[model samples]
Target: MAVVGPTGSGKSDLAVALALQLDGEVVNADAMQFYRGMDIGTAKITPAERRGVPHHLLDTLDVTEEASVSDFQREARAAIADIHGRGKRAILVGGSGLYVRAALDVLEFPGTDPDIRRRLEAQLADAGLAPLRTRLEAADPVSAARLGDARRVVRALEVFELTGRPFSSFMPAREYFQPAVQIGLEVDRQLLKDRLARRVHGMVANGLQDEVQRLDAAGLREGKTAARALGYSQFLKVLDGEWDADQATEDTIVATRKFARRQLTWFRADPRITWLDWQDPDLVAKSVGLCR
Candidate 1:
């Protein structure tokens, strides 16, 4: 079973509830949670909060290591197989759309050539993302349309140049890699917006600033992925004296809301997920029913 929703939607709590009830363990699919010393900012569940449920793939990376969807897919599937082999259920949990799909769906990762990648990146640096994006549009219009970031646009172009195939061609269909149930938590737009704002403020109150400071010393700034996490990024500005805490708080709230909307858009497009209200009184019971 997989439990997915936007951040601040209580998917973590629901996963623990279901794990306790169903004799299951959780395999984390949250990209940010993979980094060590990122607890406060990433909202990582404490050991006590887990209620003794074994979690896989959390805190496996240092601040300097990049999180890779391909690597996570292998690790998650291995964890699931190990859990099943022990007569325990494996519950996949997180809001990362790609990581969730990588764990549950039949997705393939293509190889990359460093030479090609560097060449494309240099072209992006010299020419900016527009020309590369235009080239990608002509080569793989689907990828070009969906990918807005320079990194992904470059990757799609590299894939096209290397394999003579559209990057979208590697995307898995809705078909599952194995039989599994996906439960999504749905929240009202306004309520979620408010909840996200409160969550960010709570993180600050819980020492997000200090957490960012600690990780910065541990090389968070050097990490491409970890450094760019919503709250972490903004808080880094606070560390740099570019923005004050209040400004970081407001910026994080806005960025988190935008991220939530993107998560909703991604999960809603998948017909496989069963949506449940985030505030549903019987959320765990209903989620367990789907698993059974």
Candidate 2:
């Protein structure tokens, strides 16, 4: 089983409830939650919040390491196997759409060539997103249409160069890698926006800036993936005097709302996910029924 939804939609809590009821353990699919010492900002559930339900894959990386979806696929599958070995259901949970799919779907990532990747990276750095965007548009318009960020654009280009195949061809079908159930939490857009704003403010009040400060000391800026995480990236600006705490907090809220929208878009495309209201009174029961 998998619990997926936008950030701030209470997927973590729901996952915990379902786990306790279903005699299950959780295998995390959230990428950022993989890091140690990133607890509060990632909205990572504490050991107390887990309520003694065994959780796997949390805090498995340092702030300095870049997370890879391929690596996560191997590790998460291993965790699931271990949970099944213990005679417990494995509940995969998180808002990261790609990582969730990577763990539960038959997705294959192409190998990278250092020379090709380095050349692409250099091109992106020297010229900008426009040229890369043009190349990707001509080569793999499907991927180009979906990928807007430079990082992903460069990756698409890299894959095409390496495999001589359009990047979109690698996308997984609706089939699951293993037999499983997926529960999606749905929220009203306006309510979700308000919730994200409040959540960002709460994170700040709960010492998000101080958390960034501590992670910064531990070299968060050197991390490619970790440095760009939503709240951490904004708070890094606060620490650098680029933005005041208020500005950073507001920026984080805006970014989070946007991210939530993207998450909804991604999950909505999958027909396998059974959607449930975030506020459903019988959410756990409904989710468990879907598993049956």
Candidate 3:
């Protein structure tokens, strides 16, 4: 099964509840939640919040490494197989549209080339995003088309430069695995925006700055994939003396709202998803029935 929605939309809670009812383990599909020490910023589910349901792939990586969609697909597939081997269902949960799509359907992408990746990283470090985006626009419009915006464009180009194939080429439609159900969660827009604002405030109170500070101190510098996450990067600027904490928090709220909007736009385009009003109490029963 698949659980997808905008961030702060109660998808995690629903996934956890569904997993408990189905006696299933959860495989995270969110790209950010893979990193260690990014808990508050990514809204990673805590052990207690997991409600004793097993969760795989959250906090499983060093902050310095890039966790790509391919990596997520490979790990999630193994995790699902493991759960099935144990005679339990597998619950996929997160808002990463690409990662979710990769895990549950056909995805063909190029293999890794370490040397090429290093060269592209060097270029990205020296030349900045504009030049990289221009190059990718000229070379691989297909991959570029999949990008959500400039941030994704940069990531896709980095992959393209390293693999010598358009990143999208590797993602040709081929069945990766079959999900019994695909559930999409949505709340009223105003309610979602309000929840996101409150969530940002909660993150700040939850020591989001301290969390990013720890990552920075641990040698994960700004502009790396881990640091580039929403609230973490905004607060990194606060730590760098570019913004006050109050301003950082405000900026983070705005950024999160915009991100939620984009997530809605992305998920809405996928006709396979069955949308759910997350505020409904019968979501678990409904989702379980859908899976059956």
Candidate 4:
């Protein structure tokens, strides 16, 4: 089973509760939560909050390491297999849409070569996205039309160089890798916005600024993915004296609300997910009912 929802939704707690009843362990699918010191900002589950249920893939990467969906796919599946081998259920949880799809769907990831990627990145840095976008449009118009940033454009080009195939050729066809249940928590828009605002403020109160400071000294800025994390990125400006703590908090709140909407849009598009109201009194019971 997989429990997915927006940032402020109670996916983690529900997953833990489901694990208690379903004899399951959680495999985290949140990309940011993979980092070692990204606890408060990512709202990572603490040891006590997990209620003794084992969680895999959380804190598996240093702040300097980039997260790869392909790598995560292999790790998540392996963890699920191991859990099943132990006669236990696996509750995959998180709001990272691509990571979740990579783990659960029939996705094919072309291999990447550091040399090719480095060369492409260097070209991007030197010439900017215009030249790269033009080149990509000529080779892979589909990807070029949709890829929003230089990083994705470079990735598409890198895939082409490495595999002699367009990056779009590998998009999964929504075929499930295994039989499973996916539960999505639905939140009221205004209520969720307020919740996210409060959550970001709570994160700040809980030392998000200090966490960002510690990770910055630990090479967080060099991390391709970790550096760009929601609250982490915004708070780094605070450390640089570019923004005050209050400004950082407000920015994070806005960014988090936007991210939550994106998450809702992504998960809602999947017809397989059974949606449950976040505030339901019997959310767990209803979720377990759906699983059974």
| Count of steric clashes across candidates, in order | 0, 0, 4, 0
Which pairs in model 1 have colliding backbones? Answer: none
The residue pairs in collision within model 2 are none
lDDT score of residue 25 within candidate 2: 93
Model 3, 1-292: lDDT tens digits are 8899999998888899988888888999999989888899999988899999989998887888877777788888999989999999899998988888888887765566567566666777798766777788787887665665655576577677666777767664534466457899967999999999999999999899898898998766733578779988888899889999999999999999999999999889877789988888887898888887
lDDT tens digits, residue span 200-226, model 1: 899999999999999899999999899
Of candidates 4 and 3, the better by lDDT: 4
Q: TM-score order of candidates, best first? A: 4, 1, 2, 3
Model 1 regions more than 4 Å off: none
**Greater-TM-score candidate between 2 and 3:** 2
Q: Pick the candidate with the highest TM-score.
A: 4
Lowest-lDDT window of 10 residues in candidate 4? 167-176
Candidate number with the higher TM-score (1 or 3): 1
lDDT of 2: 0.92
Q: At residue 34, what lDDT does model 1 achieve?
A: 97
lDDT of each: 0.93, 0.92, 0.83, 0.93
Error of 3 at 276 (Å): 0.9
Misplaced by over 4 Å in model 3 are: 117-139, 144-166, 172-176
